[model samples]
Target: MKHTIFYILFLATLSICNAQSELVKIEADTTNIRIGEQFEIKISVGETENVIIPKLSKLNGLEVIDSLKTDTLKNTISKKYILTGFDSGAFYVPKQQIFIKNQVYETDSLLINVATVKIDTTKVKKFPIKGIKGEPYQFDDYKNIVLIALLLISIVLTTLYFALKRSKDDQVKTFVPKLAPYQEALRNLKLLDAKLLWQNNKIKPYYSELTTIVRNYIERELHVPALEQTTNQIIESLFDFSDAKVIETERDTIKKLKRLFEQADLVKFAKAKPLAEDITSDRKIAEYIINNMQPILEEENSEVSYSTPVVIVQKPVIEKPNTLAKVVLILVTAAVILILSIGLGKVISMSKTSKNQMENVQ
Candidate 1:
């Protein structure tokens, strides 16, 4: 009795289900999708009411790019799902199962063919930036380092050169002597004292000494050449010297030396036969020039002056004169001797004179 009851319940449930649902359909326009191609899908109900068409909750291969809804004859909503996909291979639309009153319906995937595109090399895509296009090594980097090194070396060398130059400059400037003129002229004159020009009978040398004394005086004092000028020229040039603070006597002595120079030149070149007195005058003139220039020389050479050598002349000594008085005195002595020797005069005088003649005159 229980089994018969179970069979009746099952048959009644099957008859009710058959009456409620005639069919559930699901379909699509395409199944294959290119990278960017789109396609559509549809789900429909026939002879169905008071029932829900299950939502397509999942899909594969064919992406549901968009979905749409429509009201149909049975007051049912049909879903039109449009899809687009971007993959190379034949992708699939997942089987979408629909549930109506807890019953299941599934959709079939229709294929949409998508062709592989031909690449155009002529229209090749360009990268915004190309990577470094050069040799494997970077020369500029090393070059910059080398240039910097050279610059440093040059700077160091230039600094060293200037420093060395400055050091040498200081040495020379500080070490150089600042000698005064007078002392130098005096020292130079002393040098000439040792080489006596007159003692050697060297006439040219004597003139040189005279000239040198005057020249050195001028050089150390007024800084001019007394030796080089003629008397008239010197006299004319004296105005220039006098313009300086040199004493009047110094000028007069310079003029005297100028005259002496003329005399010497005449004696040397013009063969002027100068008397002893004229020569003596020359020496006196040279002495005067020396004395006159002494103050300037001393002033110039508070230290020593920077000038050439000085020349010195010394006059020869003279014998004393046998004057008339001496001659007379000798005559009286001779007369007295003659009287005393009159007795032995011939004998003594003849003997003495003969002996003196033979020994000294011979």
Candidate 2:
């Protein structure tokens, strides 16, 4: 019985020594500071095994500026943190728990005092305000020079206009017609296919160009600003527009386009690798959408009987006048008026001066 009791005591002492071998300590640089002043907290761990650091991104009343790395020695590791507080008050840095080898160890909480700068009312003083200064104005300061410059510019422009008018017949007339939106989109898709962008591993640029062509077509054909809209935003705007009009039939096409844009976004942003089948599917969808959305050509309207089953009535299209020509005409007329006004004003001033001289001589 005596031998057994001594053996038990020896085991208890050994266990206590083993537990005390490892130590964890936390130390701070200071305990008090003015508000927004920074201080350091050093955490030291002895006999470090597998250890997990606590997340210290934000404290209740304190802000973490930087967390320094653990300095490793033979059997110990030390970590340093810089923290600050913006409010003036007493605050507690919460206890940090560390996990190691299925066991938990925690640091004791720390208390810190933050104070604001003190101000004294006895040291304040008052001063009188200064008077404002004024600048004298001149009536004809640089006005004559500016008017003369305007007159000269108008004369030069008038001379150039007549010269260009006379030489207009010698210029070649290049009448390049604008391509319809559908034609432009189809041509671009053909060019894209020839390049085989996806096969060449240029997926992002390929999708970007593809989406741009589709957006431009939407803007030109439907007057939608698809280029500047996100996928979700474009869908929402289209749905709103459709509710007001009879455009429910185009919902399927919009959904297909949305899927294509999302897939492209994944490839461009999320680094997704698409299958060959997927690329072919997208191409087919694009082609189908463009073909279906092409502008319909109408033949001349003929008189039809009232008993006809289906009589498709086409609305007459009105063409707008050339806006550029109107703008140029307005600018030319304004310039001519300005020149004539200046000339008349100068003549009236000269006549007044001569009349005054004649009166003085008499």
Candidate 3:
């Protein structure tokens, strides 16, 4: 009886020592969860050196969603796994094997419960499905249409501007019967008199118009470009023409013209106000100049008629329209119409679809 008692004590001590020598431990953060819910499992080993932690690849009624790397701190190495269960039932995290140096260690199994979510159907209300809603229109939806409209307006305005400008220019260049040089000069002088310029204290304008008339007459009759020449230059050119036998003019006529020009220049450039009598005298002198040059003009015309028969012909100008611009405008207009039609059709179709959906819902 004493020997049997000692042997039983020795076996019990050995069993306790083996229980305390366990190196692998496994635990779980939670044991209860709803279906499709996740939990975590932690594994620890007391030894860090020469240990290999195996991955938890499979579980019963559960999935190993994630496996963490082994962590070492001081004398402990640990691993973690994220687990999720899809079925509502009790699941087991099976024992995991770990290798240490020359021995294999196993962790105890863990239990988990996954329950289905509960809902009280009596307290919950049911709702019918809603119809599809149409989205509100945005500026971006009509951006192309607006851009095309603006482009079309700009093109039309540009075309109109050019067309009107061309028409105005053509009107300015339209044919009008020209008066003879002498008659035109006389008519302008009479018009100047009717203006009452000097009487209205418009001295400079009066002198300017007076000088312009004489210059224009000389330019048209003698073809001397008198309008572009200075007063002194005109006198010199007239003397040259006399020397060249281009005109039959007396010294008196040239002197009178020189005096008129000098007085007009004084009024224009020096701002000198001429006396009323001097203005009247200048006007008379202008008429004298015009009449004096008549005989020379008649002589020239006779010589021209004797030499060659002249015919004056006036031709009308016709400008061709911009065919390329028209073609581009037509194409762009068509494109705009086509895009608008497509957009309208889409809108109508969407409206009909929405109406039908609403009717079905009702």
Best by TM-score: 3
Q: Global CA lDDT of candidate 1, please?
A: 0.59
- Rank all candidate structures by their TM-score, best first, as comma-separated numbers: 3, 2, 1
1 or 3, which is superior by lDDT?
A: 3
What tens digits encode model 1's per-residue C-alpha lDDT throughout 1-362? 99999999999988765644346556667655557777777777653555565545544544667767665765555768787766566655556665566676555545555556678998998767444333333566357545655665566556445433323222211233434554545555566556765556556666666667666666656655556766577666666656665444555565676678777777667766666566667776665566665433354545653544344433334334347645655565565445544634554566566666655543
Predicted model with the maximum lDDT: 3
> Tens digit of lDDT per residue, candidate 2, span 212-242?
8887877776567888988898778766666
TM-score of 1: 0.29
> In order, how many clashes per candidate?
22, 0, 0
Residue 189 lDDT (model 3): 100
Would you list the C-alpha lDDT of every candidate in the order shown? 0.59, 0.74, 0.82
How well does each candidate superpose onto the true structure, as a TM-score? Answer: 0.29, 0.35, 0.47
Specify the poorest-scoring 10-residue window by lDDT in model 3.
166-175
Q: Candidate 1: lDDT of 251?
A: 58
